[model samples]
Structures are given as C-alpha cells and as structure tokens.
Target: MNLESPKITLEKSATEAFNFLSDVQNFKKLMPENISKFEVLGEDKFLFALKGMPEIILKKKEVTPYSKIVLGAAGGKLDFSLIGNISEIETNQSTVQLTFEGDFNPMMSMMIKGPIGKFIETLVTNMKTAI
Candidate 1:
C-alpha cells in the first residue's frame, strides 16, 4: 500500500522543522490520541502501540540534512517506510509532506488501506499544527 499525505505549509524554517522531527521522541506529539503506549529507545528508534494495533518499532533509515528523513521497521509482520520531505519556503517558513509505503499481502492491504491512510493524513495534519 502506498499513501501520500497532504502538503503542509509550516510557520517555521526548514532547519527548525527538521530539528523537531530528527528526534524520534517528538513523534509522540503527532500520534493519534488512541496511541496507548510510546517508548523512546534511542535517538533514532522508538516503539509505539495503537489502541487496536500491535506494537511496532521504527527507526530512522536515512536522512539528509534539513531536507528529508526516512523511517522504517525491520523484520516484522508489517514492513513499511515513512518518509518526510521538507523544503524551505522562506527564511522563516517551510513546506512539508509525508508519505507512507507498506508491503503487505493483497488481502491485508485492502483491509488496512483506509484506516492507515487516514492515520497518515492525521499525522501530517498534526505536524502542521504541532510545529
């Protein structure tokens, strides 16, 4: 399954936003309220549980200074990647977008697409407000 989040114009510089997102712990503020647990294991890794979903651990897979951050989960029932893209709009403003890609069986993809898409959308929307 592949899903792209809406682009958001943020009231912060690209570097500022990048700094906020570089730390995985800050992600808790962007999660759905239904998230039941969150744990920060390292600067680049964290584990989280959603109300009706199994706990998942994600770690930074790659990053480029002030421009992009990619996160992925290692061996698991769900193989997925979440990417964040940032661009400077002005000295004090930036544009941000998020995309989520998941590798799942056809049946599971069809079953989870809607909910997962909405979840990513919510996360992107919250990023705009959270910044």
Candidate 2:
C-alpha cells in the first residue's frame, strides 16, 4: 500500500528542512498528538507508539542533502518506507511532501488504508507547523 501526504509549502528553506528531517529524532515532534510514547534511540533511529498501535521503530535509511530523506522500519511487524521529498520554492521557502509505502496483503490494506491516509495527513499538517 502507498500513502502520501499532501504537498505543503513551509517557511524554511529546502536545506533547512532537509537538515531537520535528516535527523530521525526530530520526527517525534511531528507525530500525532495522541501518541502515547516517543523515544529517540539514536541519531538515526526513534521509536513511537500511537494510541492503539504497537511501537514502531524508524531508522534513517538514506538522505540526499536538500532533496530527500528515506526512512524505514528498523524491526517491526510492519515493513515500510517513509520518504520526505523537498524542493526549494524561493529563498527561505520550500515545498515538502511525505509518502508512506508498506507491504501489506489485500486484507491488511483494506484495514489500514483509511487510517494510514489520515495518519499521513495529520503528520504533514503537523509538520507544516513543526518546521
């Protein structure tokens, strides 16, 4: 399954946003308000738990300066990739996008599509104010 966050314009420059996101720990600040626990395990990894979901550990997979940051589940029931794409719009302004892609069976996809979509939307919405 593939879930995408809406493209958002942010006040920070592309490089600034990239720098912030390159450090996976910063993602804890962008999670939903209902998240029960958040832990920064290391510079490249973090764990978080939502209201009804199991803990998920995210690790930085790759980062391309001022362009993209790719993250993946470190070890969990879910196998997924979260990608952040950044583009410069103007001086001190940037366009940002987030996408979540998971490997799920049909039944699981049906169960998670809506929630995942909403989660992505909430994440991006919060991210707009975060940066």
Scored by TM-score, the top model is: 2
TM-score of 1: 0.95
- Backbone clash pairs for candidate 2 read none
lDDT per residue (tens digit) for residues 74-111 in model 1: 55778899999999999999999888988899999999
Candidate whose lDDT is highest: 1
TM-score of 2: 0.95
Alpha carbon lDDT of each predicted model: 0.90, 0.88
Candidate 1 clashing pairs, residues 3+ apart or interchain: none
**lDDT score, residue 111, model 2?**
94
